[model samples]
Target: MTPKLKEDAQRLVIYIGESDRWRGKPLYAAILETLKAEGLAGATVIRGVAGFGAHSHIHTAAILRLSEDLPLIIHVIDTPEKIEHALELVRPMVREGLITLEDVRVVRYTHRYLNPLPADRLVEEVMTREVETLSPEMTVAAAWQKMLETLIKAMPVVDNSGQVLGMVTDEDLLERAGLQQRLSVAERLDKPLLDEEIARLRQSPLRVADVMSKPPITAQAREPLGLAAMRMAKHGIKRLPVLNDQGQLMGVLSRVDILRLLSEKPAMKMTAPLGATQTVRDVMTPVIPAVQQDDELPEIVEKLLESGTHRVIVLDGFGKAIGLISDSDVVARIQPSQRRGVIAALFGDALAPSSSVTAAELMSPGVLTARPETSLVQAARMMMNPKRKWLVVVDEQDKPLGLVDRHILLRALTAG
Candidate 1:
């Protein structure tokens, strides 16, 4: 029998505007603070690479043509009562913009931080150390074995200099294999193919360098959870490589980490509770999957698939996450149409040509982001108010950090 999905009347709304006149950072900070003050779960901001408004003016980040016409999207997610409370707060700021609300189902809900004792508190207290790593020169076989031994989906790739170059994960490895299979089929076909095409497939090797994602995304250990969530959503990734002050790989964070944190917390009941004082860092997953940028994509994809994770963190020469590669990202690089169709359905958009594109081609860069110190309340407000399900978390340097999903917050509330 299909179990009935425990339904909650939690509603969220997102806000967008076309002017850069406002202080984006401060606005985000304020939103987070406001949500926390009101006892909401979280909020988030999503930056757009390009956008159009009622005026039909194209907005972008080109310096010479610096289009102030760009739009900003703000998301907030919370209980029905909290949603109303948050809307009242942002009403004054709703000038020359768009605000839309959508209904969302809460799969889980809880308070991420229950105990305040020093011994039982802080992310540093619960985060895992002694993380696994990978090297560019490592063979696909060796990397695959490591993933099996460690029971992890991704690994950080480092060099002799202790610098992170990229990341490799099971997803990346799988994508490479799929690519190889496609190449092999094409080669076997009797149809006359270009010499370049034949040579590319013939020479393709399942090496770490061939599969690893370059310019990996990373985060500092001390960063907050709010920022990390935002980064994950912005990049459409599920993991963030953690680094130390020396730029050495410290560990990795994953969506599962966030979910686990939510699982450990108390579930929220129907009665409205008092405001929460916790931050994202208080609940972020300290252990993560990392890999070198130069690792073979096929090997990484294999590990990721085996580990049952959707994303991997890529590190640079300094052992810092510089880029991220998710199953969605890798799939987009290979199969654009399927990815596009899925994304379009998720966003409630028509299955048009624009919707049928890959994450690499469709994803917006220079994301609207938040820092670790940001409040969960504000994060929730951003996510709920804008009705956005995902938020990217970043450090003060605006590097990719982690992600916060509406479902994650809701789970915490339910668990509370």
Candidate 2:
């Protein structure tokens, strides 16, 4: 049963014809859904027995034939701000109806148990207090140095007053730091783009102001950590710049920060609610050692056992992945012996795959993969079905870029 609102709380009463609909959904249902989705405290939908509108057309639910135009009232009792926001959203939905607001003190508002701790834990609790901020005038080369030294994926581009103006990431630096500018001095490296040449190119004069992703979407430190996690995932960011009410940078919240916290929480569960808007890249293990398709079974098995990967990518001569061999395939193939099942435990499903019978003989015909940008939620769903233990993170050409497993989903859930 739905909980009752306390006596004397602000209530938004929306009256619309039962037949009214916005975007094909019944107006009452649409509004109620919106209110609930928006996390409003409580809402109720009432149907009138008899009523007449501005058109003077009488409507009644007393009989089935005339029920079409019955008066439908949606009662939403919450904070004033929520009611006002919901009112604006309902305005365009009810093309022709009456809406009213009243001050009713809610003495019995309920459903408290549903939320573990709404707005109880602020972002400041889990945010990294020490932030490595970037200045608009800081050279891309300088920023790259910091990124590599700290191994932090992103940093906020802030003004002298500490107000965030933009955000810069390693990818932003890699692309704009002149690394792709053909060795800067050597039009095209007659040799290869070596570490030295790349370093020289990175020393170019491009500034953070020129390369950062500007007009960054930010979050307030006082808000719930879940809100910050949602913003990060929704925007496909690994971390968010924590800001004060004055819009000044305060700290940074990262997937790792949240993950470490969540992983330590004894109450944390894989099903814990969280925003999975963060991409696979946030948690993916970027480097998974690979083996050729023809690599022998014993050698591959040994590698899978030691590498701690359930499946390994089988690459062709050109380094293009052709297939995958998993520990499951090995378990299914090997003539069972009395020896303990150590390999099975090591792989947990190998965690990254083949042996003769050869990698070609044991591999799953087509390797399942996910892109770096795939949302964690979507990736979780993809990884969950078909009993897949893990997914190979791939690039545009289906080149193996990394690997993501069930742990990724767990981290995403807890980060919220």
Candidate 3:
């Protein structure tokens, strides 16, 4: 049995004439550039032998001299959101042309793997160009709004000479917005009350300079990517502003870039060895906090802040773990794939024009669980999954007992 097409995809078709120009440049070239700039995997352009549309003019390549305005089709395939982005980018450039979108299933696809750049690659070599920067003078409210729209977690703040001044992250913005006081997602709230709170937070009269981390941690363009990673991990920073010898911002690099680098390096997946382990009960955190499904959102946030833990488990009447929620689940504007769909529902009350909601609506549904009697190695193995972040430790009767965090797996790997 071999692998076949088993994934959903989308294809965008753009119908344009060969002579079409955007900003005085060839339309086809402009479209290709846009797709590449947006980080799409790939695209193809097909030239038609003969075609006529809209104006009903006969434009054919039958004769080389009369090949003017020959029909061309640009095909791009990618995720739905990315496809939408491509369309938005091309819409203004394409003044006269037909653009259509359709669903497609990816079948057999093949490509030669490109070798990953050496680990010692310079910071500038891996940093993304066209980085966005925040002005220290920008309002905290405006900054959060911008970050929300762009799906960026952090941004570098710069001075007038393009000098890196500081860095601001979502966490910084949220704390300044006074969200910590209302972090509990399991609180009862009237629609208007939630709206007022959200609105107030957004309208805070604070500037980026007031909350951003001053004298930002940065990477020199000449430094190795590994050094940047070490600095990032040591400081717990998500991204670093790349600066040139002139002390001006060059670009930006982050953990995501490192992940991409590892993905390209096939030889990098080294195994982590470990010693024998006994039972899940021996390693599990026996004392775990529990929240009910129907609890209010505010109460949930309060519990999370007070506990200082990454996440809290949700339990049903019988004390069995039903679901779970974390701080990211409540704060992230866009829910990550790793989180349950209910994460978005967490904001349902906040976004709804008029409504009230509970913790059940905001939790990651159907929690991952492990039995206390299960082998510690097996539990650690389960936690090794990159996407499975947290799990509930349960008793013999499926009652809530403890939690198995990602940290537990790291500890297990070193137990040998």
Q: How do the residues 318-365 of candidate 2 rate in per-residue lDDT, one tens digit apiece?
A: 777788776556555544441124233332333222223567776777
List runs of model 1 lying over 4 Å from the truth. 1-126, 177-206, 267-270, 273-416
Candidate 2 achieves a global lDDT of 0.67
Query: What lDDT score belongs to each candidate, Candidate 1 first?
Result: 0.55, 0.67, 0.67
- Residue-level lDDT tens digits of model 1 in 242-290: 7777877777766555545644444455433333445555444444555
Candidate 2: regions farther than 4 A off: 1-119, 180-199, 268-416
- Candidate that scores best on TM-score: 3
User: Per-candidate RMSD vs. true structure?
Assistant: 22.5, 16.3, 23.5
Better of 1 and 2 by lDDT: 2
lDDT for each residue of candidate 3 in 350-398, tens digit (9 for 90 to 100): 3212223455776778877887766544554455444565667777788
Candidate 3 at 267: error in angstroms?
5.3
lDDT of 3 at 349: 24
Candidate 3 weakest lDDT stretch, 10 residues? 347-356
TM-score of each: 0.35, 0.42, 0.46
